[model samples]
Target chain A: MMLELISRNILHRPIRTFITVVAVAVEVIMVLVVVGLTHGLVTDSAKRVEGIGADVMVQPPSASVFMAFSGAPMPIKLAGKLQELKHVRYVAPVLLQFSSSGRLDIVYGIDPQSFALVSGGFVFHEGHDLQNPDDILVDDWYAKARNLHAGNSMSILEHDFHVAGVVEHGKGARLFVQLKTLQELSGAQDKASVFFIKCDHPDDATAVTDEIQQMLPRYVVRSLKDYMSLMTSSNLPGLQIFINVMISLAVCIGFMVIFLSMYTTILERTREIGVLKSLGASKAYIVRVVLGETTLLCTVGAAVGAVASFVITHVLVHAFPTLVILIQPEWVFRAILIAIVGGLMGAAYPAWLASRRDPIESLAYE
Target chain B: MEPILETDNLWKIYHIGKVDSPALRGVSLQIMPGEFVAIMGPSGCGKSTLLHVLGGLAQATRGSVLLDGNDLSNMQDAERTQIRRCKVGFVFQRFNLLPTLDVRGNIRLAQHIYGNEFDPHRFEMTTNVLGLSHRLHHRPSELSGGEQQRVAIARAIINEPKILLADEPTGNLDTANSDAVLALLRQLHRDLGQTIMMITHNPEAAAYAGRVIHMRDGLIVDGIPA
Candidate 1:
C-alpha cells in the first residue's frame, strides 16, 4: 500500500518528475562519459606503445612516461651505446614532436631501417614505408580520420611532407616522418627524444632494462611488458584528479536538483502528509514514503543514463574514428551508485521536515 | 457503561508569536461505548480543536484525554500515534483522502498504518457498508463529494477503530449528499454499534446523534441528549 502511494505520488506531477529524472540522468552521463573517454584514451595509447614490438625503452633524463611531453633532448648517438649492450640487437632513435595544427597529435620521426629492426616493420596498407626525408607515413586510423591517402601532401610542424603510405595502426605513433627531417625542422638536429631497443631474446628484456638503467641512472628505462599495468589513471599524472573533479560536479548537480525537487514536493503535499499522520502514519513511515519516491526516480534515471551513455559514445566513436570511448560495466554501476547516493542525500532534509510536520497544522495547510 | 472516550478540563492554546490564544478552554466531555455524539458550535469555538485533541492529532495545552482508558495527553508523539492508529479513526471536513490513491488504496492505507496484513473480509465489509463497493477503483477527483466522504469513512473504520471521529465529514457536500452521508453514519451507528463523535454546526446534522454537546468560547455550554 505504501509502495502504491509512493508511485502514485510520483506520477501525480509528471512535469516535475521528468525534470528531476533528467537532472539525475545528466549527472550519470557526465560521470560515465568523462571516465570512459579518459580511460579509453590512456589504454589505447598504452596498447599502441606496446605494439611497437620493443623489448626496452630508454628516454632522456627526467622525461615523462607520456611521450608527447618529452622533447628531443637525447643525442642520436646514444642509440649506438644502447646497441652495444649484451642482449640488445637494435636501437631505433626517434624524435617526438607535439602538433596542434587542426587537431592534437603526436608525430614520430624515425630512421626507417633501425626502427623496422626494433618494431618488426610497419605493414603498409596503401603505399610504402618512409623513403624520402619529405615523406610521411600515416596509420590507417589517422588516414581515415583526416581523409588522407598516398600522394596527398600534408603539412606538419610548418613543413610540407608527401604521404608515402597508409600503414596498419597500433604502432607507436599515428604520423611517422624521417628522423633527420624532423630534427632539422624542430632545430633539434642530431637529437632524439627516445630510443626503442629490440632484445636478442624476449626473455632478456628485464636484464637489458636494468643494464640501461645502470648505464644512465637518471634516464627513464622501462620494459615494454610492464607498460600496460602503468596505463591506469592513477599511474598517469592529473588524470585521476580530472576524473574526480568531473564526478564531483556531477554529484553536485544531482544533489541540488533532487533537494529542490523533493523539498517542493513535500510543500505541495503538506496536507496529504497531515492526512497520513492523522491516519496514524509514524515519522518513519513518512520518511520512507519521501525517500522511496526519490529512490524510484533515481533508479529510472540511472537506467536511462546508462543506455544514453552507450548510444552517445557509439555515435561519438563513429563520427570520430580516431576517438575511443570504452564504457566499462563497472563504471556504469559506479555511476548509478553515485547518482542514487547523491539523490538520497539531497532528499534527506526534505524527508526529515516532512516527518517532523505537525499533523494539525499540516491538515490546516491551504 | 464506562466511558469509551473522556476529556478532563482540556485546554489547547495557540501561541502566535508572543501572544497566547486559547482554542480549547477547560472543556470536559465524555461518551459511553456505542454512543453517537455530536459536538456543535460556530467556527473558532474549539469544536475542531477539541476533536483534534481527542483524536491525538493535537496535544492539549493543559488537560488529560483518555481514549479507552489510555491517557493520550501524557503519551509521547510516537505512542499517541500508535494509539491513534490502533484505536482512533478521523474524517476531516476537506475529505482528506489522498487524491493520488484510488478509493481502495485510500482505505487500505489505514490498514497498512495499523500494521495489519490485508484483511480482505473486513475490507469488503467496510466498502460494502459504505456503498463504495462499485467505486473502489475511482480516484478522489473522479468521485462525487458524497462518494469521496464515503471512501473516507470506509478508510477511517476499516480497522474497526475503538472510536471514530468525524470533523464535518459532509461539509464539502451539497444538501442531498449531506443527508445521504448523515443517513449512512446513522445506519453504521445503529447496525454495527460503532462509536461515533462528529462535529457539525447544522442542527439537522446534529439531530442524527443520540447526544449533542454545544460549545461557546471553547467551553461546553450545553451537554444534553436531544
Candidate 2:
C-alpha cells in the first residue's frame, strides 16, 4: 500500500516527473556518448597498430615518437642482421612514406612467400603477385578513395607502380604499396623504414626482442604488446584529462537541472509528506518513497536518452567519417553509473529538506 | 485500567527572537480508555499544539506526554514513530488523505505501515458505517470535501488505534456531512469502545463528546464531564 501510494503520487504529477526524468536522461546520454566515442577511437587505433604484423618493433636511436606519428625511419640494412638471428622465422622490411596528400602510406617489400606468412595470405582481386618490384596492394580505403582499381598505375614518391590488388587489414597503413617502389620513389635505396620479424615460438619472441635490444642498446626494440602500450600510454594522459573534464562538466550541469526539478517536486508535496509522517511514516520510509519516485523518473529518462544518443552518434559518424567516435557496452555502463549517481546527488538536498520539516508546521502550512 | 492518553505538566513554547510565546502553559490531562473528549479553544489558544504534543508529533518545552503509560518524551524519534504507528491515529480537518490514493488504499495505508494485512470485513464495515462504500475506487481528489473527510476517518480508524486524535474533523465540511461524520465517530466510540480526543472551536462540535475541556490563551479555562 505504501508503494502504491508512492506510485500514484508520482503518476499524479506527470509534468514534474517527466521533467526530472528527461533531465537525468540528458546527463546519461552525454556521458555515454563521450565514453563510447573515445573508447572506439582507442580500439581502432590499436587495431591499426596490430595490422603491421610485426611481433616486435625496432626504431632508430633517440626515436621518441611512436610509429603512428614518427617521421624517423630505421635504416633498411637492419633487416638482414635481424633475420640472421636465431628463432627468427621470417623478416619483412616495411617503409612508411607521407603521400603528397599528407596521408600515412606504408610499403611492404618481402619475398612473396615470407610476406604471405607474416601478413596472413593476401587475396588479389585483379593484379599479379608482388614478384614485380613495382606491383603493390593498396588499402581498400586508399584505392576506393583515389578511384584507383587494381592494375591501375599510381605514383608514390615519384616512382610509378601498378596496384596489385586492393586489400583490407587491421595492420599496416590504411594505404599500402610495394617497399622497393616506395623507397625508389623516395630516393632511399638499400635503406628501409622498419622490419617485422615473425618468430618460431611465442615465448622465443620475447627472448629475441630482448636479444635485439641488447645487441643495439642505443635503439628501442619493443614487442607488439609494448608498442600498443606505448601508443595508448602516450595518448592516454591527454585523453584521460580531457574526458574527465568533459564528464565533470556534463555531470555538474546535469545535476543543476535535476536538482531543481526534484527540489520543486518536494516543495509542492510538503503537505503530503507531513500527512504521511503524521500517520506514522518514519523518516527512512519517507526518504524511500521520495527516492522511489526519483528512481522511476531517472531510469526511464536515462534509457530513452541512451537510445537517442546512440542514433545521434551513428548519424554523426556517418556524416563525418573521420571522427571515428564509437559507442560500446562499457560506455553505456559508465553512462548508467553517472545517471544513478547524479540522480542521488540531485535528490540529496531535497530529501533532506523534506525530512527536516516539522510535521506540525508542515501540516499547518497553507 | 490505565488511561489511554495522559499529559503531565505539558508546556509548549514557541520562540521568536528573544520573545518566548507559550502555546501550551503547563496543561495536564488524562483521557481514560474508551472516552470521547473534545478540547475547545479560540484561535492561538494552543489546543492544536497540545494535541500535537500528546500525539508524539511535537516536543513540549517541559513536561511529559504518556500514551498507555509510556513516556513520549523519553522515546527516540523512531520509537515515537513506532508508538504512533501501533497506538494512535489522526483525522485532520483538511481530510489529509493522500490525493494519489483511492479510498481503499488510503484506509489500507495505516495497516500496511504496521506490516499487517487488511481484514476485508472490517474494512467493509468501516466504509459502510462512514457511508463511503461507493467511493472506495475514487481517489481523494475526486471526492467532495465531506467525502474526503470520511475517507480520512476510515483511514484513521482502520488500524483500530487505542486513541484517535481529530483536529477539527468537521471544520471544513457542510452541515449535512459534518453531522454524518459526527454520527459515525459517535457510533464507532459506542460500538467499538474507541477512545477519541478531538480538538475543535465549535460549541456544537464539542457538545457531541462525553466531556469538554475549553482553553483560553495557553491555559485551560473550563473542564466539564458529561
- Can you write out model 1's per-residue Cα lDDT over A132-234, one digit (the tens) per residue? 8899999999999889999999998888999999999998899999999999988999999989999999999999999999999999998887766767877
Docking class of 1: high
TM-score of chain A of 1: 0.97
Candidate 2 — what's its lDDT? 0.77
Candidate models: Cα lDDT each: 0.92, 0.77
Best by DockQ: 1
Q: Candidate 2 - CAPRI tier? A: medium
lDDT for A1 in candidate 1 is: 81
Which candidate wins on TM-score? 1
Task: Tell me the lDDT of model 1 at A81.
Answer: 93
Q: Candidate 2 lDDT, tens digit per residue, A229-254?
A: 76642366487777787788778866
Model 1 misplaced regions, further than 4 Å: B224-226
Could you give candidate 1's fraction of true interface contacts? 0.88
